[model samples]
Target: MTKTILITGASSGIGKETARLFQAKGWNVIATMRNPDSESELSTLENVWVTKLDVLDLDSITKAVNDGIQKFGGIDVLLNNAGYGAYGPLESFSRDKILRQFNTNVIGLLDVTKAVLPHFRQNKKGLIINISSIGGKITFPLGALYHGTKFAVEGISESLHYEVEQFGGQVKIVEPGMIATEFSGRSFDFSNDDSMVEYQKIVGALMGAMPAMAQNASPSSVVAEVIFEAATDGKNQLRYTAGEDAKMLIANRQQYDDATFIGGIKAQFGL
Candidate 1:
């Protein structure tokens, strides 16, 4: 049987890898992005139908969903992978920044899920895997708001699993640690507001540690395989950690209670 899958934020990173992975595996891919033409790598793929979908725009989401269904018979899985990083301190972060986080991470995800529910209900079975992060469970000093959005994804995805059981739909969350993507370089899209400048000591340490952190993370392909496994055989498990780093991070999160964690963070940056 041919399975159809819809992936958002397919322009790059983990989403890009998943699009290619599934397409090679014989799955019909409806890959959506804010701008499709710019995604030459994805658009050139024979199995993927790259389309425009600005998650921030409700109508764009609706159109993309309809387009996916039109291109493929019906979507068997939907991977909500669209998101951006917002850095800085809570006090310094703008409400607009925070709101955009929720809007893109929470509301946009919910809208697309809602758009797909009826179709899944009609099909009698479907899967939804949301891309969360290690930060979702254990956050860092300056990542307050981005962590909040991931936590929201965790909460929403788990609960939706409960709500959709009667309808034969299942939901799962895939939390990944730092991967060797342009996530750090390109994903730092937030206004880099002078968030914790007052706490220069703490902030500087964290900043210095980032270069090392990026070096250690695995490539996006590792995370994509995890998503593929979860989507293929996700028997109602609520969450799957995408990489070994995520596994260790989640397992020892409690060991570094705030004080130790911050200390280690500072030590890395030579603070």
Candidate 2:
């Protein structure tokens, strides 16, 4: 049988690359994004369907899932890859921005998972792959809110596994370090307020280092490959860390105590 995978936020970056890789691997891909009309290349591929899906909207989530199942006969995997980074001092963030961040990154993820649960449960087989981040486990300056959401994802995925496994469904988390993508550029939202001058120096220093960090980062295709492996590996593994930076950081954090890890991170970022 030709298995299908429905991916959210598939317009660009990791989501986009993952869609392409899966299609190349002969999987039917439902590439859902906020603006499907704007996508050209993915729609041109065989066994690939580009549809509109906004994770924050329940109707869109349900429709995207149904559309994929209808077109591909059945969906074998669900990739929760629709999210963004909302970074910067928490104090600089407005109430609306904070809510939006959680809505898109955390709440939206839960809703999509809920929409797909019945299908997975009824079919007795499915894979849920969440695109979390190294930030989910470790924190950095000005990433409190972003890290909070990813941590929520980690906790949610861990708990969901116990329930889903009873029905032959599996949940996997993909934690990728800084990748060279729009995620570091246009996809990132940085909070800044001129009135909060006290935090400017640290914030500026972090922002200054981002371009250089991105230069040394891995490509989106690398993370895409990891996602593919997680989907097809058929192992009971709960987490897969992508990129050398992510592997090293996760290992280093695990080897050190909280204080030591915090100190190491601060020193690395020159804080």
Candidate 3:
């Protein structure tokens, strides 16, 4: 039987790579993004359906899921990889920006998962892989909003597993460190008020450190491989960390207390 995987934010980065990987492995892929018209590569692939799906839009979520299921017969896996990084100080953001972050990352994920649950329930088996970040377990200098949303994803995926497991559904989380992608380009949102003098030092520090930090970024393909493993390994694992940096950082976070961990971050940021 041919299995199908539905991937959100599949126009680029880890999502696009994962779509290609699964398709190559003989799985039908529904590669969804906010604007499918702009996509050229994945659309040309066999057994890959490129469709429109904006995470903030519930109607689009439902329609995308239904359309994919219909196109591929049935969806065996769902990869919730549609989210951007919202950085900068919390106070610098407008209400709309704040709401957009939470809505897209938190509420929108729940809505998509809700739409897919019925199909999984009917089939008696399914896997949901959420693309969280290393930040989900540890905080950065100016990622309050971004980290907050990922933290929410961690909690949500953990709790939802218990409920979904009763019906043979499983939830898995992939925590990837800095990935070599356009994530810092079109997918990144940074808000800052220059007039806010208090945040200048930390902002400058983060900006200065970014280049060096990016030097060690693992390619999106690395995370894609991990996603493939999570989908097919069929293990009872709940969390999989991708990238050497993510493994080391997550291990440190698990080993250290609040003061020690936070102090380490502060020292790294020159705070």
Candidate 4:
């Protein structure tokens, strides 16, 4: 029987590309997003079902999972790829924005994972691929809240792996660095305050350097391919880096002490 994979945030970027790649490989694709009606591409593909699934909405999460299973017989993989970055100075972040970042990136991911757990537990075989970031393992300026959410994901996935292993379920994290996607554009949130002139200057400098940082970034499709490997590799691999930059940076981080690693990041951004 052909396997099925359910992906969140399938309207664009890595999720969208992964849905296409899996469909191309003969897997049933449940390509979910917040506004399924607005999606024109994935909805038209064969073996691909575009459905509404807002990770923050528990009802939608359960509905999407059920809908996928109902249509495809069973879901073999769950790709938790719905998330966004909240950038800018921590002081400039309002209470709502900070909460929103955590709610969407961390809490929402957990909810979707919870919704799929029963099915996985019953099947005794399943894979969960979380679209974490290089930020999960390291930090950068203007990304305190975003990094916090990713770090939470890393820790949560690590702990959950042990619990699920008893039943043959697996968890894998994909860490992509500066992928060329709307994630750095429309999907990104930037906070600022006119009253905070010093912060404005600092944020401006950081934002200015972002384009250069992303110039050598890999495309979203590259990350999609990595996710595909993580899902099908059938190994006990817990973490996979998606880009050369991610691999290099993460390797450097592992080799260096905390102070040295942090200093390298500061030097990279001219901090």
Candidate 5:
């Protein structure tokens, strides 16, 4: 019997690649996004079940979970992949924007997991794959808010694993370093149009290098493969680091304590 997986943020970036890969592997892929129709390419896949979901919206998450359970017979895997980066100095970001980041990246994921747990516990078998970022493990300039949200995911995923282990449910987090995605294009509240005067000196330099960073990063395929491994592979580890850069990142963090490691990271960002 083919397994079924539900992937959020499936309209683009790593989520899109993951959806395509699972469909090819013969798993029933439920590709979810806030607006499914925005990406016509996803609509063409016969094995994919596209649904509308906004992570911040509880009604949408609950309804989508029910709809997925009905069609797929219960989701074997749930990929929490809907999150955006809110880059720039902490001072430049509004409280509302920071809250939005945490809501989608941290709380929204929890809500989705809550919606899907009953189904998983019923079967006593399921995998929860969370797409966290390397920023979760390491600090960087102009990414304090984004990193905070991801760090929450890292902690939440770690905690949930132990909580659900007895029930045969697993939670795994994927930490990817920068990847070639529209995150740069859709950087929430990190305005290219309006510069923050206070941090423009560094922010401008960082923005100028943003394009280079995207180019040096791995493609979505790197993250997609790691997601597949985390979902289906054995050993059931709590975390999977995606991409070469991410591997090096985890290594650096493990090699040094907080002060040294974080300072190294700060240096890397030219802060």
Candidate 6:
């Protein structure tokens, strides 16, 4: 069978790159995003179907899955890659902003996974690949909301594997460090209240460190390749770290205790 992969947030970044990679490798791709009408590139691909899927909207998620299955005969893999980074001091966040962060990143992922469970269960074999981040294992200043959601993703994927594995289904997590993508642009949300003078210093520190981080960022293609590996390696691996920085950070995290690891982050940000 020519296997099909359904990807979320495929309009740009790693999602778009992965869709292209899979299609080039002869796999059918259902490249979904919030606005499909604006996508011109993926829509032109032969085996790729560009569709609409907003993680915050359950109806859109379900419809995207069903429509992809119908178009490609059955989805063999589900790539939960639709999420953004929400940064800033926790105190600066509004109730709605907090909810939106959680809804789009954590809750939305669960909902999409739930919608696809039946299909995977019936097939008795499937792959669920989630795009977590290095932030999931290590925190940075002004990243409470983003890190919280990614940490939730890590836990969910790890625990969900236990349940799904019994029926030949597998769940995997891809932790990418910092890919050169538009993530810092349209996909990033930073909230801050300047009136809260206490947070200004840390905000300035974070802003200053960002440019250096961008300079070290690997291309989105790097993460896309990691996702491809997880999809096809057919190994029982639970997690795959993408990018050189991701590997180094994950290793350091494993080698350090809470205090040491946190101190290193503080030093990096000059906090």
- Kindly report which residue pairs in candidate 2 clash with one another: none
Instruction: Give the Cα error of residue 4 in candidate 2, in Å.
Output: 0.3
Return the top candidate by lDDT: 6
Stretches of model 3 off by over 4 angstroms after superposition: none
All candidates in order of lDDT, best leading = 6, 3, 2, 4, 5, 1
Query: Over the stretch 1-271, how does candidate 5's per-residue lDDT look in tens digits?
Result: 8899999999888999999999988899989999987879877887788999898999999999999989878789999999988887777667788889889889899999999999899889899999998889886667788888988899898988997788998988899988876455463457333555767776776776677667668999989999998887876688888888788878988999998987775676577
How do the residues 1-271 of candidate 6 rate in per-residue lDDT, one tens digit apiece?
Answer: 8999999889999999999999999999999999999999999999999999998888998999998888888999999999999999999999999999999999989999999999999999889999999989988899999999999999999999999989999999999998886447677899999999999999999999988888878898999999999999989899999998889998999999999999999999999
**lDDT of candidate model 3 versus the reference:** 0.92
Worst 10 residues of 1 by lDDT: 187-196
Candidate 6 lDDT (Cα, whole model)?
0.92
Model 2 regions more than 4 Å off: none
Off by over 4 Å in 6: none
**lDDT (0 to 1) per candidate:** 0.84, 0.91, 0.92, 0.91, 0.85, 0.92
Each prediction's TM-score against the native? 0.92, 0.98, 0.98, 0.97, 0.93, 0.98
Cand. 4 Cα-lDDT: 0.91
Worst 10 residues of 2 by lDDT: 178-187
Q: For residue 62, give model 6's deviation from the true position in Å.
A: 1.6
Task: Indicate the residue-level lDDT of 15 in model 1.
Answer: 91
Question: At residue 6, what lDDT does model 6 achieve?
Answer: 92
Put down candidate 3 lDDT per residue, 49-155, tens digits, no spaces: 99999988888998999998888899999999988898898889999999999999888889989999999999999999998999899999889999999999999
Model 4 weakest 10-residue run by lDDT: 178-187
User: Which tens-of-lDDT digit does each residue in 109-202 have in candidate 1?
Assistant: 9999999999999888889989999988987667777888999899998888887787888998999998886545566653444544676665
Please list the residue runs of candidate 4 whose C-alpha ends up more than 4 Å from where it truly belongs after superposition. Answer: none
Q: Candidate 1: deviation at residue 34, Å?
A: 0.2
Model 1 residue 67 CA deviation (Å) reads 1.5
